[model samples]
Target: MNIWEYIYSPIIIFIASYILLRFAGKKAVSEMNSFDLLFIVVLGTIVSEPLVDKGIPSALSYGLVFTLVYILFSILTLNNKLRWLLITTPTVLVRNGDIDEKGLRKARITTDELLGTLREKGYATVKDIEMATMENMGKVSVIPKSYARPVQPSDLNLFPGAAFIPIPLVMNGQILMHNMKYLKLDEEWLKRELTRQNIAFDKLDDITLASYNAKGQLDIDTDNDEGHNHNPYMYKPGNTN
Candidate 1:
């Protein structure tokens, strides 16, 4: 009833809820397995004790502790070894265009489920997939067979090379020495190039990007450092004044 209890109650409940969820395990929400679902429901009911019992702030305290525990556990899992404990490795449902019946059974995925997932991914038949994987997230990934796959640019007789040669320049408030070395360029050359284009060096910082195309055409993107509204995103690197 007191203001202190009112403010602290929710905090406690949240912590307790979080900790209980963490204890239940990461699979508890993401995997959507039957057992994990049951555990979460039961845990939530048990952690609701203090909320119903007005005399004791048990629910709030429990919730607060639970939340902290969940967060800490997540952080721990993000580091090296502990991560595997929280998440399962991806399961191969199909390999080399062949279905892995044993792996499918282990993953608890039915044939219908597998086919449905493939269909959703534009593979109406099993033969269409060269490889099928049931990732840890429980989503089925399908790689189309070479014959069934769409033709890429290379397949259409296009040369597999850079669409445009990238011209590198320094624009992030510091001279990019590595880029200059890579391009066999120098500061003096850069200054002269900018001078030829009638651009100021101090205003170079206004340039978000600058590049050169394959033909060695300099592309300089710049904006008004004077705070005038301009389309900064649309400005290409070498198109500056």
Candidate 2:
């Protein structure tokens, strides 16, 4: 086989692959319905055929044709009249805190699975749920009874501080100097804060993780912390490599 075949075949396949990826990847795997998943699985096999047989031109053509068909089918699903042909409608699994056995059987989901899904949604038991439905994407949507739901801050007329994303300032017993500089923090300030936390400045290597938030808070985890161990960093901060 000529070496040029390697470069030529890949470039042809890549153009076809990009179209499939660009359009078909709009939804995450967890969000794909049965038809969508099947289409993707079949299209993937068609795209890979070229790699196995070196049938580059024909494989690319079939791959692109199927991709366009999938896209057209997807667009048709947007219309109410055509949606029924494309996707399965949601099934009600629970109604008014009572399990709908028939609905569960229709959805092919066992009672145990329904209870587990409800638990994951933060409901301890079905008694608090007004409705639970199995969506087309295979995820459960749980709605709690209004009276049984937890109260929100709005209900108490209280405003709390906005949550801030925690920035990593240290990891694996080494300071992330870039993040510290981003936060306008210096080594002296970090040492002082560690000292205030009763951690010796000389024992920085004992720390495995540290993060700071905009709420003027410093959180630190040492090697002794659960699920962490004392592993020294291979390279110190400020290394270009």
Candidate 3:
């Protein structure tokens, strides 16, 4: 009735309602069966009464507690039945480049919605998708067919298949003076690399990422190009084959 009472009542009711809702289990909105929907509607109505009425009664409070217990028990049973309820589990919207029409109908998802999800994943055609699943979280996950996936350098016949890992040589105009010492190379060699790139030693601050090859070449990348390897000699001259 008072401001303090109003605030405390809402707070208490919210805490209790949250606990009940948590005990109501993890059925997603899309995954809720008909009975779960009824329980949700009833739970909402019961929780809303305290907000609407001027005073809450002991009987109403007891009734809400009973309803919460019943709902919790029902949720436990439903969660147990989840193994048998194939519909509640995420349905395969597409499989092996074919749309499962029965699954689409059961999931109540429109063709347009499916298309939109595919487009969001950069897929222009259904043939590109090997499998698509409508997750319980209401998100669509798609796996592109092997043929539809991006062609790697190896697939393009450009891979030498050598195991190589590039390590940082310099960063932000500060010579990794320790790295030079590790590779038994001096600052003078690094300066020569900077000279070859026509960039000043002090101006290496413009570099965002830099690495050294097995051949001890200082590779430099600038912020202007998203730190891509700007080294002219990444591939030697006339070796495009």
Candidate 4:
């Protein structure tokens, strides 16, 4: 309630949280497994107690001590002998397009779960994947078979020139002035391009999204065809019109 408690406590808590999170490593936060999730929940409860409870004397000091202890243990776990005690190694779920049933059982993941993860990653069947690894953080990383991979423009010996990142000029009927400025483009140039495409200045509201690349490729999507179904593979290199 006091000014010191309000400001000081939050600053201390934030610093402690940041240190603890950094010590835990990136995977602990980015791709958290069941154990990592539990660790975070417990850590949150412990860290938040001192801030919430005003009756406790030396609360900030206690928090700092606890956080430092956790960081020390995290550093100790970096040793080869102690690393396995803290972190799980990645499990090979599929190898050479064959399912590793034993590995799956050890990881406590079902075949259906593995299949579902593969499908989410664009692999429809296990045979399409050369290797599927379940990372320590519980994320499925896949290596597709060479035959299943799509051909790149380079494979066809086509020099399409350097591709520039498309900058969005408009989104949901609003002009993105910041993106225009970043691309060193002005409103007059955009207006001219829109007018050339038969889009009137006042009719800009009809456009849902509009982007342009350095190669003069302008992509425009309008709100008029929300229900339109287009083939995704139609734009592929060898696809017929």
Candidate 5:
């Protein structure tokens, strides 16, 4: 109701919410089931009531007290023995290519859901996985069998140059001046390159997208030709491949 109450109440409530979330554990919020979602909705309504209702003078004080109690209990859950009692541990859903039916039942995850997740990760069958863990956060992490894993570039002693994230230099015929500056490129340099590519400066208005990276050639697309075939090996000494 007063200035001090308006200021301190929100700060106290924010601290309380943070402490409560910390106690709830990361999984409780991230992998929220129906119960967790309901708890959060109820908690929000309860905490916010005082701020909206002019008649509730004691609500703010009560919220602060409740927050303190929550903080104390949260600290107690830090002990390893007590933590297990409060929080769900990661469940081993698959081990050595065998599905753990008991673990799936305990986690309340269906066989269909497990198979779907495995398929999403490109594993067609459980036998392809050496280990699969259902993390407390409800994410499935799979370790493929060594034979099933794809070979890395490093395994062949290949020294591919450093990777560069492509930067968009132009979109919808408009030059991205900020990106050009970030890439330490000037308008003159871009215009010169465009001219070399036979992209007339006057016809830049027809261009839709243009992007470049350190290791690759500049790419350009134009709105004028929706079905234009761009040659990959089109040669430009310094401007393109």
Candidate 6:
């Protein structure tokens, strides 16, 4: 009911929620499994208790309890016997270009819905699908028949070496010295290259992103720094100009 309670409740709860969520395991909502969803819903309810009649201490305590339970449940799901009760099994809906009517019924999806899902996955007809399965997370995964799939280099007897992930030399206008070191590059090399692109040293932060690819190419993207805004409450970085 008090203003102070309203102000402090969200701040305290946010910190608690973040810590608990990190411990609980963070991932995109779309990628969350059933147990993960349950954990999130329970956490939301527990953290929101402080906004009601309950105190922050009680809410955080309850959140910790649930997080422990989530961890235990995660461990239990790893066992084959316990896994059946914990996790939903993936169901095959199509195999060998044939639709499994029983699988469709078990998955609770209509034929029309299956057709739409196939279309979204780039398959125009069921005949093109070698296998389509309903994953535990409710995503429909489709594997096209080999003959129906796109041609690849292997099909033409061509082999290309595997590539490594792209590393960033700079990000958000700040030099990633650690990454530069990892890539065996130094500050002087990066500074010289940015100068060639007309990116002044002081204006590096205006660049939204800068990445160095495996092929020895530097990609840069910049935003209008003239429209940059700063928070009055925060300490501002010193400007060169």
Taken over the whole model, the C-alpha lDDT of each candidate is: 0.70, 0.83, 0.73, 0.78, 0.75, 0.85
How would you order the candidates by lDDT, starting with the best? Answer: 6, 2, 4, 5, 3, 1
lDDT of 5 by residue, 1-241 (tens): 5789888777766676666666556644666644455556656666677667743445545544654554455566679888777656888999999999988998889999999999999999999999998875568899999888888888899889887777889888889999998878897888887887789877778888889868545688887643334655544467533
Clashing residue pairs in all predictions, respectively, total: 24, 0, 0, 0, 0, 2
Q: On residues 1-241, what C-alpha lDDT tens digit does candidate 1 reach at each position? A: 7789877776776775675666656765786633345456655765666556763355545555655555576567677787677757778888877789998898998889888888888888887778888776667777888999988987988878767768567566556778788888887887877787777776687777777567665677676445433756545566471
Candidate 3 weakest ten by summed lDDT: 79-88
2 or 4, greater by TM-score: 2
Tens digit of lDDT per residue, candidate 3, span 1-241? 6789778877767776676667655662335655566667777777767777744564247546766665655556556566345234678999999999987997899988899989999999998899999865467889999999888787977967576677787776567777778888787887788899887777878887678886668678876653335566454456552
- TM-score of each model, in listed order: 0.47, 0.64, 0.46, 0.61, 0.61, 0.81
Q: At residue 102, what lDDT does model 3 achieve?
A: 88
Off by over 4 Å in 4: 1-29, 33-39, 47-86, 119-128, 154-160, 202-206, 222-241
**TM-score attained by model 6:** 0.81
**Tens-place lDDT digits, model 2, residues 1-241:** 6999888777777777877768665752447898788877987789878878988778877877887787788888899999998889999999998999999999998989888888788988998999999899988998899977889887899888887889998788888999999989999999888888988878878888889967666798887643333335434356532
Tell me, by TM-score, which candidate is best: 6
Error of 5 at 216 (Å): 6.6
Please say which candidate is ahead in lDDT: 5 or 6.
6
Decoy 2 TM-score against native: 0.64
Distance (Å) between predicted and true CA of 126, model 3?
0.5
Superior by TM-score: candidate 2 or candidate 5:
2
Kindly report which residue pairs in candidate 2 clash with one another: none
